[model samples]
Target: MTLLEVEGLRVKIRTEGGEVTIVDGVDYAVEPGQVFGVAGESGSGKTISVLALLRLLPRGATTSGRALYGGRDLLRLSGRALRRVRGRELAMVFQDPLTSLHPMMTIGRQLSEHVRIHEGLSRRAALARASELLAEVRIPDPKRALEAFPHQFSGGMRQRVAIAGALATRPKLLIADEPTTALDVTVQAGILRLLDRLRRESGLSVILITHDLGVMSSIADHVSVFYAGRIVESGPPPELLSAPRHPYTRALLDALPHPEAEGRGELQAIRGLPPSPRNRPPGCAFHPRCAYATEASLEQVPLLRPVGERRLLACHVDPFAPGP
Candidate 1:
């Protein structure tokens, strides 16, 4: 079943200069037990798009879209109704666990309260569940760990705790926004493995948002490459990373260090900065940094249409076309 379907998601926030569109007409769907990845550079609206779906955007931000989940439009849900869905049916783990977890509160208190509110469990029951959750996420001595504050744990362990909290309600859909950010490579791999295991075991759907295409290739079944605010290319990670049709996706892949290029030279870097939301280019936002850009790319906005099996691309020129 389609877990969540978002169509024409547009986010506009009032700035001193004027209202600027952050996410423009974004569309995607998440299937049950599938890992849908959203990848892009910083300030590309990947975070803001999901934030809008959860109604967690900053003040003065307005969203227009249809985020259908369980036959209801999440964007149009009442505050009370949305609250019930937020941490129960849908939960999220933020990039930084330290900021997400309370500094003063013990892990036990936080986890217990999270489940208590959503599941209506008694204090004793909630605490026990909290310990079980910690253990489920592979935290050693879960009971003792729960008594310690967020600061007491290492960066990786703290992230595990955050993931535990997000899973406390047994949400069907989990949104992890840069869950492995700031962690060591080993820790990052561990977190990704954990997520994959949980999804496989529980049939949980996930929306994994990050700028790291390498990470996306690791666990994401499907990846949507975001530029500025729109999805430029989307396909299965294996295919998308191997033969990207979009110039932006190709540039991103080029920026990553490859084993084949070991000791070859420095990695390729995408030129120029992402356009500011206030003054995005008329056609494609990535045209400024794209090496394969042409006059058509600068003058016309290409729609995201299917080009091959399970692949969608938004581009003017065919990267695989023969030279003139």
Candidate 2:
């Protein structure tokens, strides 16, 4: 069963010039217990797409399309109806724990408050629940740790608290945007492990948005490569990572540092910059930077179509074709 199905999800915001499309015709599904990863460079609309589902987009922004969660259209939901779904059924963990967590409020207070609101538990009960949540995230001495403020804990610990807060309501689906960003290598590994374990233990589905292909390869069952507010390619991690069907996905992999090439060669960088949402190029957005771009790529947008088993590609050039 699918936990969430987003189709033709478009987000536009009014600018001085006119309304600019930030997310254009994005579509995907998150099955129960699946880690659906959205990967791309910055400004690819990965973060804002998820924000649209939560209705957390900035004022004056308009979102179109269907975000069907548990058979209900999240986009069409009223404020009160959406509030019922936000914490209890769907929750989000942001990139920066410092900004997400309250600096002045004790960790317990923050966690307990969420539980009290969503679960309707009394203060004492909520505190106990909060303590358990901290322990679940592997916070040391969780009971006492809860009394400490966000600043008292290390960066990783603060992130764990942020994860715990999102899980306080036992949400079925979690959207983690750059959850491991800014942490050290070991801390990043730990956070990734924590999320994987949580998914395994609770059958929780996740929409993980990040630019880290390493992170996606490590934990994501499926991956979507985003570019210029659209998905360029998507498939299971093994096939998608090992042999990308889209030029952009290929370029991204080539840009990753290879251990064997550590001393032999420099990391390859993708040429050209991502287009601004307001002035996106016609046809394929990645054509300017793509090595395989052809005349067709500049003429019309390629629809995301199935090219292989469980794989989707949006490009004029087929990487698997016999001739150039």
Model 2 ranges with Cα > 4 A deviation: 260-264, 321-324
Query: lDDT tens digits, residues 1-324, model 1?
Result: 899999999999999999999999999999999999999999899999999888999999999989999999999987779999998999999999769899999999999996888778999999999999999999999989978999999999999999999999999999999999878999999999999999999999999999999899999999999998999999999989998889889889888988875697889888888899999998878888887888988998889999888999999886753356
Clashing pairs in 2: none
Please give the distance, in angstroms, between residue 128's alpha carbon in candidate 2 and its true position after superposition: 0.1
User: lDDT value for candidate 2?
Assistant: 0.92
> For candidate 2, what's the RMSD?
1.4
User: What does the lDDT come to for candidate 1?
Assistant: 0.92
* Residue pairs whose backbone atoms clash in candidate 1: none
**Model 2 over residues 1-324: C-alpha lDDT tens digits?**
888999999999998899999999999999999999999999999999999999999998999999999889999998789899998899999998878998999999999996898778999999999999999999999999889999898999999999999999999999999999978889999999999999999998999998999999999999999999999999999999998888899889989987865596778899989999989999899888887789999989999999879999998888653354
For all candidates, the clash counts are: 0, 0
